[model samples]
Each structure stands twice: as C-alpha cells, then as structure tokens.
Target: MEISWLEQVNADVPLDDEWLSSGEQLILAGMKVPKRRADWRLGRWTAKRAVTAHLELSSHPKQLSAIEIRPAATGAPEVFLDHQSADISISLSHRDGTAVCAIVPSHGVVGCDLELVEPRSDAFISDYFTTEEQTLIAQSSQEQRDHLATILWSGKESALKALRTGLRVDTRTVSASISDGLDYAIQDEDRADASVIGVSRGWYPLHVRYEERQAFEGWWQCIGKLARTAVSVPAGGPPIRLSGCPRL
Candidate 1:
C-alpha cells in the first residue's frame, strides 16, 4: 500500500494551545528553549494533521485536541486518540520551520527525514558515511556535491528512523544509492498522474543497504534547497499526499 504523507510550514501551525491535548500542552510548557518549543509544536501539528487526514477524522480544534502524540521509550513518537493507542505508524521530520509526516499501516514500518542541502566537511562525511557513500560524494561534481551529500545523509537518517535506532546506531552501517539520470527539476504536471500506481512523479527511487544484509526500498526528492526521503520495510508505492490540510 502507498504511504500517506503531509507537509506543513511554521505559518500553518496555530500559535495557541487549543489544538493540543492536555498532556501535550503540559509537555510544551516544560520546554524552555524557544527554537526547541517551536520545532516541537510544528512537529506535533504536522503529525496530528497527517493522522487526522489518514484516519478520515475531523480536523476541528476540539477533534485535534483529542489526538495525542507521545514519545515511546525509544524516543520515537506514538499516536493516541482519546487516550487509546492508534493502530498506525508515523515518522516525522522538521527542518528550518518546515515539517513532514509520513504514515503507514499499523503493521508496516516507515521512516522519513528532511534536510537542508548545504556543504559538509570531509571529516563530517568520513565520520558518518560508509566508504562507498564517501566515494559517491567524492565523485560528484562540485556543483552537485552539497545536494548529493544531503540526499545521502537524509536517506541514512530515514533508514535509521525506520530501524528505530535513530543516531544511536552507527550510521556507517547503512549505505544509500540514488538512481542514475535522475531529473531533480521535474515539475508536478510533467510527472506521472496521481492515478498512476507507481512511484510518484518528481520523486527519485532510492535504495538503502543495511548491515550488508537487510535492504530498504524508498524514494527521495529535492524541494528547493531541502532534501526529503522516506523508506519502508515492505516497500511502499508513491506517497499519497493528504488533502484538506491548513495553509497560511
């Protein structure tokens, strides 16, 4: 089945706590740092919106407040509705005031990440990436180096999230591969129609090899200066964007 995903910017999130569950509001109040608070709110708002849309529930503030997102022992977010656990899996990523959430069936596993396309030092790359990944970055043109590096790193993060290990595990244990002849500039209209049953248009195929044994199938895309990736265990079709989300 295709995983459903959604994206929301800072402006799309409400400034008030009315949409937040009581537990969530208490958690928000405990955050002291300004940026951390803002990022947490943005992530929660995005995740709630994605969950509501995926479950075909109402998006009203009262309804949203009934949905709670709490962290598990592993620090991964878990979804609860009216204090009951929801049977779904979701992964969230936020960067530069923008957040994305990917949802899959309860029995399925998924991980997603958003990263800014920027320069990384050789030491940074060598420290985290596998030798093959470092070689891929080294062979890329100077103009594409930053973007390539960002995509590679973002894919690793996604895979790590899927594994529920986050950065706790050695990143070098996973290797990412981008498709050949990828067109980063493909427009929404220029790509395949939404009715098509395959990888979405404008998104490129990506494969992540883990521990020289387990493999993950996923997709990646470049949106402006940001790189986004989603990986799943059983593999997923193109992401189905959830409609009716708020925008500002």
Candidate 2:
C-alpha cells in the first residue's frame, strides 16, 4: 500500500487548545515538563493535520478536536475520530522543533523518524549499532560520516517503531543499510526552499534486518542537515507527501 507522510514545525502548532480533544487536553495538562508538553503538542498537531489530509476530512478546528491521537498499550499512537477508533496506522517522531507523521493503510504497520545530521560519539556507535553498521560508518569519509550515521540511526528507530517496541528492544537487533550506488547529491535549487528540503532528492531504498533476517523495507532521504526515514511491514511504496499539510 502507498504510505503518506507530512512534516510540521513548532510554529505550525496552534497556541490554543481548541483543536485538542478532551482526553488530549487532560494529557497535556498532566505534562509538567515544558519541553515535553511542547513536543507532545507539536506531534499531535502534525498527526491530526496529516490524518485530515490523508482522509480528506475537514481542517476546521472543531473537526480537528474530534480526531484524537492516543497512545496504545505499546505506546504507539492510535487515531480516533469522534471517540471511535479510526482504521489507520500512523507513526510519529519529533526532534528539534520539527515533527513528521506517517500514515498507512490499517492492514499494514509503519513507522517513521526524523533526525538531525550531527556527530555521534564512537561510544554511541559501538553501543547501539551492529558491527556492519559501524563498519559502514568507519568507511565513510569524514565529511559524510555524520550524515551516514544519522541515516542508519534514524532507520533503526523507524524499524523499532514499526515493530511496536520502540527503544524497549536492543537497537543492535536491527541493522540498517542504504542501497548501493545511490546518488546523495542535492542541487543548489533544491536548497533554495528550506521547507521542501529533501523532497526533490526523492526516496532511496533502505533495508532493516531484525536479528539477521530481512524484516522491514523502507526509504530514506537527506537534505541540508536533516534526515527522514520510514519503514513498514509487508513493505510499502516510497512515501508520498500528504496534500494540504504544512511543509517542514
């Protein structure tokens, strides 16, 4: 099935709680940490907007209030419309004021992640990544090391989310690798619009192996210093941007 994705930043979230459902409001009120509350709001806002766009529903605040995103027992976000469960699978990730949501058909499982391309300590690589993943990073040039590491890490997180275990499972249980010989260059024109970032670069195939077995297939792309990855069980097509949602 075709999976759709949307991106939103902190500025895109509404300041008022009018768009949040009663349950969501209660959850927000219970969050004592300001940063956690802000991140939660940003994630919910992005997921609601993505669901509306994917389902072709109204974008009005009142309508959005009826669509709630609640955590399942496994901590995966589940969509609900007017207090009833919606037949859709969604995954969310927020980092550094930016959030992304991935929507897929109900029959399939999906997960997505967004990460900034930054230096990771050697200890981190050894602690979380598989031997092969570390070797790939070590082979990368100094200039590309950060970007490659981010992609691999983000892919692992996405796969973990798809497995519905998140960080509860060992990250090394899953190994991520990019397809061979894929061009990573981004043209100047593509950088002119910061919001569109890597969309123009298109999606590159990513494979994630769980315990040495091929378990999830997905795609990854990078632009500037941002990397996005999405993986799904039963596999999915390259993520298509959901219409009517704000850009990153």
lDDT of each: 0.84, 0.86
Tens digits of lDDT, candidate 2, 22-99? 889999999999999999999999999999999988888888899999999999999999999999999999988989
TM-score of 2: 0.92
Best by TM-score: 2
Lowest summed-lDDT stretch of 10 residues in model 2? 181-190
Candidate 1 at residue 107, lDDT? 91
Give lDDT tens digits, candidate 1, residues 45-161: 999999988898889999899999999888888899999999999999999988989999889899999998779999999999999999898898887788788988999999999
- Summed over model 2, clashes come to 0
